[model samples]
Target: MFFSLIFSLCCVTAWALPQYQPQYYSFSPTVGRGHGESFASVGEGRITGVRIWEQSNSYIKGFQLKYENVWTPIYGSTSNEETELLLFEGEAIVQISGKYNPPNYIYCLRFVTSRGRSLIAGQPTGNSFNFYPVDGQSELQIVSGRSDGTGIASIGAHWALIYRNDSKALT
Candidate 1:
């Protein structure tokens, strides 16, 4: 009887304690129109590089992400200039900042990595936004958003740890 009482108390105590929930992912609020468009880099692999096509003095035209060795299809149209950022081993994107005009159109973007390296593109001329991991233990795992045929109209980011595989490590 005493053991049963003790077990009940233990169960109650445990139940009353805060549950530890592991965060698998966190998402930054979608910035821009975020309509009629979608792209995701999640579940493909770790992001090894970023490519942004931008019209000089204007909005971001399109972008693509390199997952390990493979590059995803560009989300928008190619433009006058293209900027690419390659991430070093053990590095991950931790922050993304950008500007978006009213209605639609992402004007500029900046990607900051864990190693303090940053890649900036497009023309900075609109409402500004900053995105980072909410849990602080995650990195950029997914890049999804909307794009008009001509340019990027909206964007969002998902944060989480990438699945590790030594063979697929970036060159």
Candidate 2:
């Protein structure tokens, strides 16, 4: 009976646990100005991860992610790093707008997936931001202008996407 109980508990634990297969995607590199705006789209799926990268010494002040018409704000400082999320799905729009110190810093946004592979919709360039749609995914837009206040400046920007084969399927 003890052996049976142990087996049952193990089975329950396994069933309740979730499998993580991490995938990542990013927007193309572009120059951002103070108060300038950049937009990228997260394909339809479960978003289990997020990350921000500042290729240069400059930093981004603030940003936002819009999903289903809800705006989720993300703030940054002198350091560029990654941020984790529980699980988010549906269509997402990332809008990064803020001041970039040093005027010509480089930056990029990365999105990780929990299940299924990431479809790369853009590629990074040294001087320009280009979108290379995969699976017919939408293009990422990085614009320079004032959204809330005076825009900041950046040297370049890029997008990267990562996909894992072992992640659980998105429901």
Candidate 3:
């Protein structure tokens, strides 16, 4: 009787407590040829800057992202004109849209932030594609894709809720 009473109390307590569901990241469909070459800039911290190298009136040649104070290695080779965007405090990238060419190569990229600011690079040619979080509560967290030796071949985005150093939610 004692053991049954204890077991019943435990089960009731467990069932009464609130269940916390784990948050999973949502991935946007990758766009472009997606050759074997690969690169990833995952969640290190808040994104602080973005630099894109592109041929004049042509495709994206290289890309780099700054996480917190660190910069990821350049994906693809760096040559020709380069465009850079430095984000302000608490700003987050909320949308990504671009164009991809046949065979390979990302033709253009436009990044929109939560503050309504934007950064655009490359030429607006090729097929159009867009990426953003469907969960509404998440922001851009991971940028992964393939890059040919000379230019970006494909790109994908991952979105998740932002967390502070204390593990508190920021978004």
lDDT of 1 by residue, 1-171 (tens): 999999999999999999997876998988898665576654466777998999888999998888778898888889769999999887778899999996869999999988889889988898999999887657888888887688888898999866567653322
Query: lDDT values of the candidates?
Result: 0.84, 0.35, 0.85
TM-score of each: 0.81, 0.27, 0.86
Candidate 3 clashes between residue pairs 3 or more apart in a chain or in different chains: none
Kindly report which residue stretches of model 2 are placed more than 4 angstroms away from their true locations once superposed: 22-30, 36-126, 131-171
Per-residue CA lDDT of model 3 for 20-134, tens digit only, reads 9766479998999969688888548878788999988889998888888889888887876988998877777889999998687999999888888888999998999999988
Higher-scoring candidate on TM-score, 1 or 3: 3
**Candidate number achieving the greatest lDDT relative to the actual structure:** 3
lDDT against true structure, model 2: 0.35
Q: Kindly report which residue stretches of model 1 are placed more than 4 angstroms away from their true locations once superposed.
A: 1-19, 163-171
Off by over 4 Å in 3: 1-4, 7-18, 22-24, 165-171
lDDT per residue as tens, model 2, 33-81: 4434543333333233333433243333333333333434443322343
Candidate 3 has what TM-score? Answer: 0.86
Better of 1 and 3 by lDDT: 3
| Predicted structure 1, TM vs. truth | 0.81
